[model samples]
Target: MSRTLVSALVYVLANGVGLLVASLVLGDSFTFTFKGFFVATLLLSVVEAVAGPAITKAAEDNVPALKGGIALIITFVGLLVTNFLVGGMHIAGISTWLIATLLVWIGALIAQIVLPRIPVKKAVQKARGKQPGKEG
Candidate 1:
């Protein structure tokens, strides 16, 4: 499958397993599925922030803001399934997740700008059908 599809599947599986475990361990009062979704988004953001530049550089291209937005939507829905597995839904604490996302974004931007050269080179080579760690 495509890399994006694989990532989506991983995200869904991670959240689903988390929710199932949470439900079994926590009771009704543990109803914080929304929080999980938000947190998961932030988690994905952090992953993107770190791996994004590499992936972009490997391909020497950006997927466009629209593509990123669609990825976000897919991530959100995947988490939704996780929340369903956990229990119901309760978004009593969304601000925390937002804050975390912002922090992750800042970090991602910094890393991408500072250490982008290597990734860019790798992306370019990869795009040309060259192996990453071998002389062509």
Candidate 2:
């Protein structure tokens, strides 16, 4: 597939996993129906794709000191926007909101680091198999 498609898939999967972690960790305070999980993931992905760059740019320009934490803020904003825009996913309690944001942000960061490795490993294995003196 194209690079853009692969990137998009990665983002969706990462967000889905992140949201799953949040729901599981925050239990009563964060709830999602099966369908709501997928809906929320897609909504979050869209929101991040559309708004993330702009937000990051504004932050970079206005407060360079926030560069490191801008991603966390963006992720939190995505959750808030998704919560307001989508149905079935419910978030309650101030503490839960904060925890959910941190959980999703950390989950996505983990996914970003780990998910791409699988394909890369496969490609490396295939390349090794094609080496000149290699036997099948």
Of candidate 1, the 10-residue stretch with the lowest lDDT total is: 96-105
Question: Quick one: best TM-score, which candidate?
Answer: 2
Model 1, residue 50: what's the lDDT? Answer: 54
Tell me the deviation in Å of residue 87 in model 2: 1.0
lDDT for each candidate structure = 0.46, 0.89
The residue-by-residue lDDT of candidate 1 on 29-133, one tens digit each, is 234555654555445444544554555454435445455444333333433443345343432345533332333334334443444365568989999999888
Q: Which residue pairs collide, candidate 2?
A: none
> What is the per-residue lDDT of model 2 for residues 32-86, given as tens digits with 9 covering 90 to 100?
8888888999999999889899989999999999999988889989999999977
| The best candidate in terms of lDDT | 2
Q: How much is the lDDT of residue 105 in candidate 1?
A: 38
Query: How close is each model in CA RMSD to the real structure?
Result: 13.0, 3.6
